[model samples]
Target: MSLPEVRLQIAAVTLAEELSFTRAAERLNITQPGLSKQIAELESRIGFAVFVRDQKRVELTEAGHVFVRGCKDALALLEKAVRTGRATQEEIQPLVTIGHSPYVDPVLVSALLGVHLPLYANLRLRVESMFAQDLVHSVLSAEVDMAIIEEPADSPLLTLVPLVTEPLYVLLSTDHSAAHLASVSFEDFGKVGWMMFPKRANPTLYEKVMEAGKRAGAVPVEVHHYVTPHEVIQLISENFGVAIMFKGIAQQLERNDLVARPLTAAGLQVNIRLVLRADQSSRLVNEFGRAFLKRVIPQGQQAEISGQLLLKL
Candidate 1:
């Protein structure tokens, strides 16, 4: 058996967060001395002091920070395992939540909803909408079993199943100088203006665009942030600025003098992915993921390749 059992790990993690024996013990509904003993046992078993304490204050050791992070992840995984196992044992229709960013294409979302698996006929899906930034946290915390998002931050703990890879498109007024061109570069945006969603909506993609603009010397004359495609349409109609977005979004908003043109900025591609926890162990959830990939593969040959590549990875 492991020396630092779940109880010891919990104690260490709590104490590490609180940095106070009294508070940690109270939170755990244990005596301060009991908490101390558990931490001592953990340190002795692991042969490392996770905390430094004198009379007034407590602090994590250099190694303690790393250990505590691992403890948190381990505890989260254990909790998920218990919940998933209990659901499988008790529920006739085990619910799997699938969250998505509001910006995800409607076609892909429809594809996901259309998937059915003969082996897991009782599996049910609950869909939720969130911004891409929050979707990442929701997936990592197991709030949702998986997420369909665009341009999430890189994490080793996540397995990103790429669903679609396409060039970003820009929505500009028909009267704009670059409107006649089949493709516009970020440099064109520098001369005009740039309108996009706020960074909070999708920090990774927002930063990527900003970085690309910097690399291309395409500094925008003015910057505007918008929340919805309708707002993008309004801004473009007024000749406020050009909005850069995924191809689907641009195409959807192509009307009323708004035109969609591919952005020729290198490395500025839009990547839509189905994100799953790398450590997911539930058979039902894994099967649902496979079913989803299988369902979307029929959309195109590129989609089939994406599905096969996801399986290979």
Candidate 2:
């Protein structure tokens, strides 16, 4: 990472303030060698030496005096800025992270943001989208405070909330013969090329889809891996391969060349659940979840939820 200009200025000011290299190093909590290196780097950047040092004593040069004064002024201004920023930043909502695997629900996210953004004084919400395994790892490591994901089996550390249940749909090209059917089964598409994401993306969902195909007593000769929903859609649209995805996502789509049919063979339900680490505590995430539920879930259904923190959106 690049060193900040403020860092160099702070180092210069710290050295100038203390005068003694040992005292300055102590104040900076860095070794004397580290301090010397820092000063050398700063000097290199400025294209001039700032200090003169012998074995016994250290002194600032004429140019060093001028630079030190400017640095001191800049540091004072920076200190004032830090104080002001802290005051303002305190009003900003605590950073609450919410994680998702692939595309969960854009509509719900938008509505939640719109309805409750102004409700809290310090409730800044950050959304992170990643592969299911990575999301689970994030939650496990406390990198993400909460997550809406399909797989709950990987991390036993999480307190889960069963959110929404939707049927899996088989995406088919409009030109495909099975597209004419209202719904299709894995058995029907057994011989067809299968477009699937890696198991790491979502183990539970991937296993369910694959198991469904196996239960149908047939497997595709070719399996194509895709990275995203749009890629899957693009492949299916071009008659490349077919894929299984949550039906709710398909409802929000307006594709004329691709059709999503309910995959009735596996009876697999896409469980998009909200999960947080059981060992961790996050009032921010809980409050955010409450705000989200208030906008989405009805009052009658709200009381049915056992706990505020674990309740799914």
Candidate 3:
């Protein structure tokens, strides 16, 4: 087979991992039409149809499934040979690149790197910040070694591990009347000015927030949209608008003048997950994951335990 044919096999395996062409295109860093053309060329050479494409979604045929398994094994062997060659020339450190969503706990990243830094001082730990969808795509494509995303992506090529779940909170200026209240309901703040991230950066959260507002009979007055959490909090502190954010974000903010209260009416929680390629069997990845779980999970559980202790006291 030609070099392009081999590359096409890798792309097909990735596409099989994610059933959607749109997502597969994003993972491959190619346009949708380009990906389709490559797939067509590969099929023509192989003389068999690989995907059953309908209007809504695409499904792999039985032959496609078998071919994907073989391709993955071949890719792994080729990668190993390359790594072996590099190791003979120099002591090449194994790198684990991780991607994170804006909502992910920075502490988790810090802790993960901290544990592995001493053990493998030569190893490199790189972190990039992006939206959940992009982070998931990066992990599936092996662009980054792994990712910490807000929610799991619907892909068979990646394995998702639940990290921690945190309650959602509404952040407002301390001077606001609602700031003094222990809790606020959506009904009470229906007409209030609000700040939110743009739909592109946070599609899942944006949709859920809009849906929640509708369910609570609130018509959100968008004072600003597509603002970062740092900017949102700054605006709130200056009394520009109110923002709904995950509780972890509140903990990270150094501004003591801002108040974050539980939104009793919203009743939404955000889940943080660690995503890595299903085929990856790297020791460093597993070590990093374990380190994060060891540090963050206990802290999260302790908060719950402390709350229960206060009730008994």
Please give the distance, in angstroms, between residue 217's alpha carbon in candidate 1 and its true position after superposition: 2.7
Candidate 3 residue-wise lDDT, 1-313, digit = tens: 4334456886788689889889887665445776798899888878887898988989999998887888888877766764454344234666767788776667776766676545667777677998776676566546676777774644556666666776667787777777778887677564677777666665666677778878988886665774467877667656666787767676576366887777775536676777777666565566666565556566545444333211110
The whole-model C-alpha lDDT of candidate 2 against the native structure comes to 0.69
Q: Which tens-of-lDDT digit does each residue in 82-186 have in candidate 2?
A: 445534653563566777866676766575456454545656667788876567657754567777776455333467666677777777877777888988877
CA-only RMSD, every prediction: 10.0, 14.4, 7.7
TM-score of model number 1? 0.71
Q: Candidate 2: minimum summed lDDT over ten consecutive residues — where?
A: 82-91
How well does each candidate superpose onto the true structure, as a TM-score? 0.71, 0.64, 0.69
Cα lDDT of model 1 by residue, 13-83, tens digit: 87887899987765554457767888889999999999999889999999999999999999888777866
Q: Between which residue pairs do clashes occur in model 1?
A: none
lDDT of each: 0.77, 0.69, 0.69
